[model samples]
Target chain A: EADIYQTPRYLVIGTGKKITLECSQTMGHDKMYWYQQDPGMELHLIHYSYGVNSTEKGDLSSESTVSRIRTEHFPLTLESARPSHTSQYLCASSEGQGRNTEAFFGQGTRLTVV
Target chain B: QQPVQSPQAVILREGEDAVINCSSSKALYSVHWYRQKHGEAPVFLMILLKGGEQKGHEKISASFNEKKQQSSLYLTASQLSYSGTYFCGTEMRGGGSQGNLIFGKGTKLSVKP
Candidate 1:
């Protein structure tokens, strides 16, 4: 099915190491977003993009950053991973139509900073 | 801003009905419902637009109130498969710029057969 995909479904890394979580979609949706969540907790928006070449910070201040070099690709990178950054990262995309335009989510990447 | 979901968690018996409520502080253009099982991604349930509109599939449905900034999800004849955490996300009028939906903490529903 045409959907969003995230790589390395699970990641365990050491502190101070750099890592990038990959997110890609084949839907050609113009808007993409990244959300962080602890188990069974509220999802916090970390980063988002309106389209290719456009990226912005979300409501939650994140130590990681994202890049939208292509319309289908929006990858998040942490300069230096920390234990505080350990959480499940979810990637989603939306179409700017209808009052109820719902976003589609990826399987998510669970990062454990050891 | 993040929306608030009521009845943080609920336990139901199979074939029973349950209601989950979500309220936002700001005016909502639309509201979305999703369900997440243990160790799984959230799956779309339904989306209710403004102006007292509603939409649903199967036994799950939802309603949206633009004025009150509230939305409710109704699950009828619940099944064991309905056991999951439900979340409501709200989109505001001027929020299209960010293309992001503020999500509620989520309501955990356990359906015992």
Candidate 2:
């Protein structure tokens, strides 16, 4: 389908549990981002990767960490999940720069922390 | 930096037109638009670069003004399908490889048939 995919469409976990949300792109994009969005609220960038071995924290300081070992895979991990971390995680990827470079988003992973 | 979107929420009737504006204090390289339905992921609408050009996706068109550091999305002949939250994402030059796109609070649009 030439799109981005996020695994575990929905997750419900206990507090202090380690978890990882997987995101993969089949479009071979170089840029990938992880955004945290609460229901009907604004989206906050948590983490992003430019390319392989390149990752950076986003505008929103997050307790979660991300890795970009491959061009297509960008996964977000939390050492200890908390109720504060409960939110929808969205994954997006872009090809290049400028107006032509539009980002494609995945369906998103809705996580509920208890 | 995050852009600011005006008219946080709007209600329109079918066939009516609505304009949602996005403004940023910082200069922008490009502005991207997306529409997200309730309980669904956002869908890309269009991208307007700094050149002050206009782009349209489906019935939605957007314009970017470099001088004003703002972008406006026009929804002409609104339909029930147009009911969703509209978000404007701004991308500035030289922010590392991610080119991170910062989004505004978004404008929620409700279209009634």
Candidate 3:
């Protein structure tokens, strides 16, 4: 199994609450990503980091932000959560070097904003 | 770029064969295939690196056409375990792009025994 892990496998928070979803990988992967997926829907890339101090917005415009302070950890935070943010958040990591390596995904965090 | 998947869903009987197709407008450097069951994170099935590359995992295999910017996943002798949503993630280019992968909407497959 992949060493990646997402904390709060499930979260339910009220609107306006600040929340952070934790993602960590022991694989020492340089590339990390956050994807939002609705049930039975496509996985939308929201944020990604090539390495420490490097973060980029994904194809989807999301209200959440992420930081890559350590190679093993990338966390997504929302200043003020909303009901619209209720969905599954998946974290993935892959080896870098422009190798196009396969991504390893965590179990994912199911967030429900009430 | 986000890839497009055809036949939003498909139904198959045990032992039947099925194919799911994915296409992208942007040039593809690599194609990644994944399968996800209900309320679960997607599992990496396979990846095709080179153009016109074909790889197999058990009864499941995939083919990539670089010039056409398309990839197709084939499932032979499907089993109940094959029931899930299949997604195709496309990497930016052959040279790679920060190792980011854009995915297709996904194709839901149901195998009935």
Top candidate when judged by lDDT against the true structure? 3
Clashing residue pairs for model 1: none
What iRMS does model 1 reach?
Answer: 1.5
Residue by residue across A1-114, what tens digits does model 2's lDDT show?
448999989999999999999999988898899999999999898888778998999899999999999999999999999999999999999985432577888999999999
| Tens-digit lDDT track of model 3 for B1-113 | 78999879999999999999999888777899999999888888989986455443666788888888888898999999999999999887644353678899999999999
Candidate 2: tens digits of C-alpha lDDT, residues B36-105:
9988888889988866664657667777888889899999999999999999998876546238888899
**CA shift of B96, model 3, Å:** 9.6
Compared with the true structure, all predictions reach lDDT values of 0.87, 0.88, 0.90
Which sections of candidate 1 miss by over 4 Å?
Answer: A97-100, B52-55, B95-98
* Candidate 2: count of backbone clashes, pairs at least 3 residues apart or interchain: 0
lDDT of 2 at A104: 88
Q: Rank the candidates by lDDT, best first.
A: 3, 2, 1
Over A4-114, each residue of candidate 1 has an lDDT whose tens digit, in order, gives 999889999999999999999998888888999999888888888888898888889999999999999999999999999999999999874443466899999999999
**Residue A84 displacement (Å), model 2:** 0.7
B1-113 per-residue lDDT for model 1 (tens digits): 88899999999999999999999888777888999998888888888877656665667878777778888899999999999999998777774533467789999999997
Docking class of 2: medium
Clashing pairs in 3: B29-B93
TM-score of each: 0.94, 0.95, 0.95
